[model samples]
Target: MRLKRKVAMALTSVVAIGALSACGSTPSKTPAASGPKKLQIFSWWTGVASSKALNSLIGVFNKKYPGIKVINEAVAGGAGSNAKAVLASRMEANNPPGTFQVHAGGGTLLSWINAGYMAPLNSLYKQQGWYQDFPKSLLKMLTVKGNIYAVPVDMQRSNVLWYNPAIFKKYNLTPPTTFSQFFADAKVLKAHNITPLAVANHGNWETTLLYSDVLLGTLGPTQYENLLTGKAGTSWTSPGVVQATKTFLKMMQYANTDYSALHWQQADQMVAQGKAAMNVMGDWAQGYFTTALNLKPGTGFGWAATPGSQGTFAMVSDVFGLPAKLSNKTATKDFLKVLGSKAGQDTFNPLKGTFSPRLDANTSLYDAYSRSAMASFKKDQLVLVIGQGAANPGFTQAFENDMVTLLSSKNATAFTTAVESAAQSNPL
Candidate 1:
């Protein structure tokens, strides 16, 4: 319904413009020459593999659009906090960049739209025919109030469990199926003086991942969606939710002693070095492991769907949101076209260890784990993870705070209460 309406509106505008262009009674005059424009893009990617991937895209973008100079404004801080803070402040000041990084969620972008800091790209979307290439479901994610606002670069599956094959073989353990088996394996690994779960709780995304696994794995799909959507009077106080939280905290006891300060990369190093048995993070970690640790799946390490979780894959795609009121410059349009093009996605997602957001891209470009993820995505429905994507950025922060406190204190009751308060205190 919405697509039809938008297409009709675009056609109407095109016809109207055509009528006006036909009425050329006056002599044509030479157009004024304009200088090249510079567009600054702000992002938080600082890791070796991530930065390399981004630079590769930037190099391609520069070649495709010669008149545009892109100045990278990358800030390093707690996960993505530093970059996010700067973007928020710049947007509020009406000094938004030409393009900025956005997560695959409704929370942060929705807030920006409400604040009048966002510009819809519906007309541009129609002109580029992105709707045909991007899947209907994936496109629906960036659509709000009947308008498209962003271009997704890739989709990250957050419920992946990575394990060291050498360690598993040494322990004579097979991949665990149910949650009971998972805990039992952890115990076995612990007795043998191996850190079973490699976790780095320093970032908000890490905390958010823990929340996602607990909610989706333990609370079940219906209840998880109900709680995230505020459709039911559900609270984290439920036995299922509490039990999940308790299990998460208990699992941390088997983690490395330096887990408190280690980053995800450091934790990944632990698994790569065979110092740890397992690590649960997004598939993007696979890129790092492959690049930095020289890992090969089914040999050095392996990937699996998180155990004890019976639900669809929960994902948040990384996208680029252009400023709404961009300068009517040729360079700007060139950049937008490149982003929406086929070559861009092909060049970006494979090295980043994520699949392209476009539904029509060649899945053959993906790695083994990515191929598995694509297979799951095709068969299993995808649910937008609320903590990462649907809820407001502030609400995400609140959840993160509660998680950090709960994990460090190891108090399930306090954690449940904190989550309840966060849910009740609407950040919208």
Candidate 2:
């Protein structure tokens, strides 16, 4: 369930600038020059692939700028909630790290921006010509009141279904294209004693995927946004939303008995090992595919969005927030330049199992799914996931909790009530 890495385990700490002088670890003479300083970067990158991605980017930075060293101070956490708490404590103490991971969305880094805890990147953005490279949808996420507060690293498609291709072929099943077709296929899978949905409910993010797919499939893109944005009331009891819940309940009924105890990797393994038929997860699950299971993306497994979705995609992005204290400073400016540089994005994203933030990234370096995601981004139909769409972490987790309770209990009325509660209590 834990996704972030232990910084102490993976990283060798560099002595802080002032600490070098305190310990007499610096060169002889005038009290240790703190010019073009080393950066202590904090992140929640735990997996081997994730660690490799961060270290690969650092390797690039090491070559390009010999003066600045990036000490990656990673922390093990649950989908970044633990990291966020630690980051807040540091900011409260007025001792923030040089950089930390944040999502590109209205509520993620914008609060820090508005509170003067994060730096604006207008100058760096313009200097690096990022305005032309980043997508408009991503730009909207990073911008707060017309000021850019974060740098987007990569994008992940939230509404993806990973299925065992061999199972599909043996069962003579084609990927479903509509909700009705999906349900029909589920029956076929169940008749053969196959678990249609391989889920890991104990991991909160895994459950959130179910809620997103249902909401998006039921409400479609436009109404889903309206509901999340508070433009419409929770009419969760509405035919569409309720029907979606029931539909999801049907899928859940076919789940393996140990779903509640499994982690994401275990569910992915179930499909990979042919113990299950399908999994609904974000695109990054492919990392567990190619690397851990030695499976190819399209050959060993396959990808498709939820049926009846009309090409609508759900997403959340990994973005970097610069501390407000460093915005106008020359040293921080130099670091941000490297961060948004072509080489920086190139080295970071492909290896990270996500699409580059810059629209101009060389797609040749990515695998099949990453390439498809980039192509999908160009179509401009991405809808922000519900958790990432909320204005606060409280709302995000509450929505996920309520949905989990609702589906786990198999009560449509209770689920609708929970949605109504989320709508009124959270207020977007």
Candidate 3:
């Protein structure tokens, strides 16, 4: 559930510059001889659960490739905002890491691929027999033209509502399935002096994440996908978008007062401590709840699809790509091989609070919430996550900035107009 950035312009600029350098030379493809090689792996996974999950994956790699030294270059920021910035600098300077984490979709990875910073992994996919392992829908995201660019490890549901079961039980409330029911529950919670929702906007992308769920909830999966994909009949200024914006503003009314001051972990903390009744977030909060807060899945916390978004799965996946000009191509591919393997995915995703993207994953290894998520992922119509990797970087940046404005202005029409304008310029 590592969302993305607010520094859209800087990232855009860096990619443009990197593209120039990328054109000047072709990267080396030869594998270095296997002797104590050091492979630098870069990512934005420094949270307690994510770190543990990464370390476990590294441990697995260490066991198999004992000769290769894995360098963990993790940077901390909500949704990889800080790390993406640093990675952009490194990529622009032509000093790429052996491999790096990226959200798998047009918004994030496509930029790197288009700029020639990433090498196509079609050969690796064929070599590992991964064409049948990962779901076709997921592999579609990793593909540009005819070449697959990265290996996906885990799949996360972005449109989930995590709640304090005790709070719901105390108020005799069921998890809301529709926005009206959600409002009703909010009324009860607020009347009881309990914050109805826990929100965090420290990175400026969380609100946009909330709004993305609202859009899916309001527009339904069909029109929501149409709007995001810029279907001929759809527009960001559609009535559904307006209503969703208004709904987002209304939902904000029940949020904690200090939302701007907290990160996502703290916001999840509010629900864990019973300071808030519900939180609309990706399933990564499950990791925080189970690992950091030491809470159980069913009794300690509860979950449901975000109101009005029952059948749709808003997906965000974490992937690692082979960067061009790597000094240790053999070591990087070894890591990617492990990353895409069934055993490796199983080992990492459970601890990461996500489900493996592999269609044949062992569901028994996952927890209650993760198993439920995996089921939805298999059957539900999947939509890429906004502010994560649904749209291009330019549009994502604009969407986040407009969400910040909408927070203070509470003007749904103006926000829709701004977003629509951005979509026009950025081509969705």
* Predicted model with the maximum lDDT: 3
Q: 1 or 3: which has the higher TM-score?
A: 3
Q: In TM-score terms, which candidate is top?
A: 3
Candidate 3 residue lDDT tens string, 188-216: 99999999999998878888888899889
For residues 1-428, could you state the per-residue lDDT of candidate 2 as single tens digits? 13345554344344464566667742222322556566777889977778888898888777877787678888887877788889888787666778888776655576677679987888888878889988776787677778888777777888888899998999999888777787787889889988887999776667767667877888888887666666755466777778878878877777787877999889989999888888888887888899888898888989888776657768778777678654234545565676677788788887788877677888998998888878887774767776554445666767677776776578887877776776677566
TM-score of each: 0.85, 0.87, 0.88
lDDT for each residue of candidate 1 in 129-203, tens digit (9 for 90 to 100): 988877777777788889888877777887778899888988899776567788899999989988898888666
Cα distance off (Å), candidate 2, residue 142: 1.7
* Candidate 1: 10-residue stretch with minimal lDDT: 24-33
Candidate 3 matches the true fold with a TM-score of 0.88
Candidate 3 — which residues are off by over 4 angstroms?
1-35
lDDT of 3: 0.89
> Which rank order by TM-score, best down to worst?
3, 2, 1
| Quality of model 2 by C-alpha lDDT | 0.76
Whichever of 1 and 2 has more TM-score, that candidate is: 2
